[model samples]
Target chain A: MQASLFVSCIVDQFFPEVGESTVRVLRRLGVDVDFPPGQTCCGQPAFNSGFWNEAKPLARRLLRQLEGKEHVVVPSGSCASMLRVFYAELLRDEPAALHAAKELAPRVYELSEFIVDVLKVTDASEIGGRPRREPEKVTYHEGCHLRRELGAVTQARALIGSAPGAELVEMEQPDVCCGFGGLFSVKYPDISGAMLADKIDDIRRTGAGAVAACDSSCLMQIGGGLRAQGLPIRTVHLAQLLDEAATPG
Target chain B: MEATTKQFTQSAAKTLSDARIQDSLRGLYGGFSKARERAAEATPGWEEMRTRAQAVKSHTIANLDYYLEQVEARVTESGGNVFFAQDGEAASRYILDLAERESVKRVIKGKSMLSEEMDLNRLLAGAGVEVTETDLGEYLIQLAGDTPYHIIAPAIHMSKNRAAELLHRGVGAEGREWDTAELTAEARRQLRDKFIEADMGITGANFVVAETGTLVLVTNEGNGRMCTSMPRIHVAVMGMEKVAPTLEDMSMFLRLLTRSATGQRLSAYVTTVDGPRGPGDEDGPEQFHLVVVDNGRSRILADPHMREALNCIRCGACLNACPVYRKVGGHAYGWVYSGPIGAIVTPMLTNLPDSRDLPYASSLCGACREACPVRIDIPRMLLHLRRELAEGRNKNAPVAEAALMKVWRLSVSNSGTLAAANLIGRALRWPLLLLGRLLPPFSRWARYRELPRPVSPFRSRWKDIFRT
Candidate 1:
C-alpha cells in the first residue's frame, strides 16, 4: 500500500533529520512512501489557540493535498491528532470541507501507529539490520495528544521494545504532559519550566541515556530543558531510533 | 473576596516561586487523583454512573426554571421560606437583613463556597454580628485571616505548625506542639462553643432536592449537621443550578460527587434537611430559609455554548486533576473557586475584562474534563472564552499577541508564504542562534528553557539526502 508523509512544520523546519528517518524507516518496511510537497502544517498552532478561522484554510489545503491517499502517516503526534481528530471539528460549519475532513481523518496515523497498526511491522530484523553497537537504555515520554487523543500509548512502546539495540526503561508518569504545548511553552514559561523540571527529574531517576517521543515538539521542549540544565540525557525521535535499529551504520 | 484574576500572571509567577506553596502542592499532587482512580475502579459501572449523572444534570439544567419553581413551592409547603437573590450583593443584603431582624448576634457557618462567592462572612461581620467558620479547614484559614487555598481543603496551603500558631492566637490554646488529632480536637472545642451560642447558622447545599424539598449536604467533619441543627434559624444558600428534580437524581449525583471530590463512596455525614422542625420534632432549626442565588448563572445557562458550565457539581475533581493548579495552588486563580472550573466560572460569573487572563492560564491539557464527574468540557469553554477575548469581546486583548497571530495567519495560510518564511529562517539561523538568547520573544522563552535552532528546511534538504 502507498502512503503519503505528513511531515509536520516543526519537523520540516526545526528537525529535518526526524522526517528523513521517518521516510527511511517506512521505505525499509517495504511500504511505498510519497512526500506530498504541498503539505505545510496541520494548523494545530492556530486551531489549538482558538483561531478556527485562521486554521480553516490550512486544514482545507491539507485535505486537498492528501485527498486520495490510502494512508497518511505523520511523525508528530500533535500534528497527527490535529488531522485525525480536530480537522472535522474545525471545519464543522462548511459542509463540503466537513465531508472531506470526515473522509480523510480516519486514514491519518502517527508514525508508530502507522508502523505497528497499519504496516504490521514490529520485528526489527524484518525491516533490516542488527545492532551496530551496545544497546542504549532509553525512556519514552508519551505526548498528551498522541497518547490521550489518538490512543497510541502502547504502539510506540511496542516499536521501541522490538528495536534491536534499544532498552525501554519506563519513566514515572509517562503519560504526564511534557509542557511543550506549542504556544504554552512560550506563554507560561514558568509553569512550563516547572512541569519540565518534574519530567526531567523523572527521567533522571530512570538513568536512561536518551529519551524518545513520537512528537518533535515534545522532544524539542524536553531536549531544550535537558540542555539548559546541563544534563547529558540525549533526546531523539522514535522514528530515528527505529530507523537506527533497522539500518547498519 | 476581591478578584485578583486580572493579575493572574503576576500572582501565578509569585505562587510558582513560593517554596511553601510548591512543597504543599508536591505533597498533594497525586494523592486525590490516585485515590479517585482506586475508588472509581472499585465501583462497578463507574463510567455508566458518570454518564447517568451527566444526563441528570443536563435534564435539570434544560428545565431549570421549572425545577427551581418546584423547589420553592415544595420548600414553602414544608413550612420553610425561599428567597431568590439575583446576585452576590443581593444575597448578602438579604441574609444580613434577616440577621438584623431576628437579632442574631452569633452566626456559625459550615464550609460554603457560595458564601465565599457572596463575601457573606465579611458582610455579616461588618454588620456587627459575630461569625465563625465551623469546618476545620475553614476555621484554620479564618483564624489565620486568609482566604481558602483550595475548595475541598481550605487550609491545604498551611502546615500543622501554622495551624498550631493560628489556634494559639485565635482560641487562646496552650503554646504546645500539636499533632493532627490534637489540633482537630482544639478546633472542635472552640467551634463547639460557637455552635451553641450561634443564634443563626449558614450552610451551602451540595444539592437542593426539588421533589422532596430537601437540602443535601455532604461533609466529613459533621460540622454541616451541627450548623443545620443547633441554631434557631437556618439559612442554606446555593447557586440556582444546584437543584435536582428528585431524590433519585440526587442519589445519582451523590454517588459521583463524594467519589470525585474526596475519593470516597460517601462522606461521613450526608445531612438532608427537608424544612424547619415539624410539630413533633425534638431538635432542629425553628425557621428554615433557602436562598437560591442566581448570581450570573442565568446568563451562563442562556448561552448554548456556555450552558454546560452550569452542569458543574462543584466537586472540585477538576482542580485536583489539573497540573496547572497543582503547581500554582488555588491562590493563583484569584477567586473563591480555583483551577479549571474557576478559570471558566470566574470570568463568566464576573466580567471577562477582569478575568481575561484566567482562560489562557491553562495548557488546554483536558485533564480537568477527564476528571469531571459531570463531564463538563472545561477546555472547550476555556477555548470559547479565549476566542471571545480575541474577537474584541473584551478590550483587554494584548495588542502585540493579536498582531502576531494575524501575521501568523497570513504566513501559514499558503505553502508559498510558509516556504519563504522557512527560507528566511534558514538564512537567519546563525544570527538567531547568537541573538536568540538575548532577543525579546526568545528572551521570554529562554528565561526558563533553551530554544531549538532552525535546521535546513526539509524541502531543500530532502531532495539531496532522501530522494536520491
Candidate 2:
C-alpha cells in the first residue's frame, strides 16, 4: 500500500529527523511512502490565529498538492486536524476548494492513525527490532487534535504497549493540551507556561525515561519545557520510537 | 459586569502570581472535572443524552421566537407577567420599577449568572431594597462585594479562611478557622431570616419550560425552593435562550446539566416553579414575574457561526475542563461568565473590542467542547469571534497583526514562496523564536521554555532520504 507523506512545516523546518523517522517507520511497515516536496503547510497557524481569509490561499494551495493521494499521512495531529476540520470550515464558501477538502479529509490521517488503523500494524513487535536489555519506559502525551479530533487514542498506545523493546506507562491527564496553541504560546505565555508546568509535573511523576507523542507541535512544547528545566527525560516522536525499535541497534 | 475583558491578560497574571487563587483553582480539574468524568462514564448513553440535548437546544434556539412567545402566553395565562428586556439595562430597569411599585423592603435571590449580567443586587440595593443572595457561594461573594469567580460556584476563588473573614467582617460571625460545613451553616443562618422577611424573591431560571411557562431550577442548597416560595412576590430573571419546549425537554437537560455541573445523579433540589401560588397551593409566591433578558443574545443568535453558544446550559463543565480557565480562574475574563463559555459569551454579549483578548485567551485545545453537556463547540465559536475580531469587527484589531497575517498569506500560498521563506528560516537558525525573542509577545514564549534548536528544512533532505 502506498501513502503520501504530508510532512508538516514544523517537522519540515524545526525537526527534520521526525520526518525521516516517519518515513522509516512507514517503509518498514510495507507502506510505500511518497513525498510531495511542494507541500508547504496545512495553514493551521493562520487558520488558528483566526485569519481564515489569510489561511484560505495556503489551504487552497495544499489542497491541490494532496489531490488524488490514496492515503495522506501527516506527522502532526494539529496539522492533520487543520486539514480535516478547519480546512473545510475555512474554504466553505469556495465550492471547488471545499469539495477538494471534503475529498481529502477522509483520506487524511495522523501518523499513528495511519500506521495502526490504515496500515493494520496492530502489534509493535512486528516492526520492533532487537529486544532491549532494559525496556525503555516511555510515557505518551495526547495532542488535543490527535485524541479529540481524530479519536485515535488507542492506536499509538497499542503500538507502544505491544512493543518488545519499550514499556508504555501512563501519565495523568495526558490528553490535556500542552499549551502550544499556535500563536497562543506567544500571546499568553504565562498561562501556557503554567499549563506546561502542570503537564511536566505529570510526566515527571510517571518517572518515564522518555515521553512519546505523535505530533511534533506537542513535542516542541513538551520537549522545550523538558529542556528549559534541564530534565533528563528525552522526547521522541512515535515514528522515531517505532523506527528505533524496528532498527537493530 | 463591565467589560474589563481587555484586562484578561493582566488579571490572568494576577491569578497566576497569587498562590492562594492558584491552589483554589486546582480543584476545578481534580474535583469538579474528575467528578463530572466519573458521572458521565458511569452513566450509560451519556453521549446520546448530550447529542439529544444539543438537538433540543438547536431546535429551541432556531425557533426561539416561537418558544419565547409560547412562554409569554402561557406565563400570562397562569397569572404571571412576562416582560422581555432588550438588554441588561432594560431588564434591570423593569425589575427595579417592579421593586419600587411593590414597595419591596427586602429582596432575596438564588444564584443566577443572568442576575450578575443585570447587576441586579447592586441595582436593587441602590434602589433601597435589601437584596440578599441565598445560594451559599453567591451569598459569600455578595457579602465580600466580589464578582463571581465561577458560574455555578460563584465564590470558588474564596478560601474557607476568606469565607470566615467575610462572615466575621460582613455578618458578625464569631469564628475564624471555619471549615466548609461551618461556613455553609453560617451562610444559611445569614440567609434564612432574609428568606422569610423579604417582600420579593428573585431567582434565575435554569430552564423556562415553554409548554407550561414553568421555571425549573437545579440547586444543591435548596435555596431555589425558598427563593421561589416564601416571599410574597417571586421574580425570575432569565436569558431568553434558556427556554425549553416541554417538561420532557427540561428533563433531558436536567439529566445532563446536574451531572455536568456538580457530578450529581440529581441535585439536592430540582425546584420547578409554575406561575405562582394556586388557590389550593400550600406554599409559593402570590405574585410571579418572568423577566426575559435579551442582553445581546439576539446579536449572537444573529450570527449563524455563533448561535451554538446559546446551547450552553451553564453547567460550568467547560470551565472545569478548560486548561486556560484553570490557570487564570474566572476573574480574568472580567465578566459574569468565565472560562471557555465566558470567553465566547463575554465578547459577544458585551463588547468584542474590549474583550478581544478573551477569545484569544485559549490555546484552541477543544477541551471545553469535550466537557460541554450540550456539546457546545466553544472553540468553534471562539474561532468565529476571533475571525470577527481579526476582520476588524473590533476597533482594537491591530494593524501590525493584520499586516503579519497578510505577509504570512503571501509566504505560504505556494510552494515556491514557502521554500524561499523556509530557506531564510533555515539559514537564519530561524525557528521564528530566535528573532521573536527580541520582540514583546514572542519574548514571553522563551521566558518559560526554550525554543527548539534550529535544523535544516526537511524538504531539502527529503529527496536524499527518499533515494535510500
Please give the TM-score that candidate 1 achieves against the real structure. Answer: 0.96
Candidate 1 deviant stretches above 4 angstroms: A121-126, B170-177
Q: Give per-residue CA lDDT, model 2, range A170-220, as digits (tens).
A: 997888999989889878888999999999999999999999998888898
Going through the candidates in order, their DockQ values are 0.61, 0.78
Please give the distance, in angstroms, between residue A15's alpha carbon in candidate 2 and its true position after superposition.
Answer: 0.6
For candidate 2, chain B by itself scores a TM value of 0.95
Candidate 2 stretches greater than 4 Å from native: A132-134, B170-176, B392-396, B430-435
* Candidate of highest DockQ: 2
Q: Tell me the tens digit of each residue's lDDT in model 1 across B108-139.
A: 99999989989998899999999999999999
Q: Per-prediction TM-score of chain B?
A: 0.96, 0.95
Q: In terms of TM-score, which candidate is strongest?
A: 2
> Model 1's CAPRI class?
medium
RMSD each, Å = 2.0, 1.8
Query: What is candidate 2's lDDT per residue for B376-436, written digit by digit as tens?
Result: 8888888888888876455455888878878877777667887777667656766466677
* DockQ measured for candidate 1: 0.61
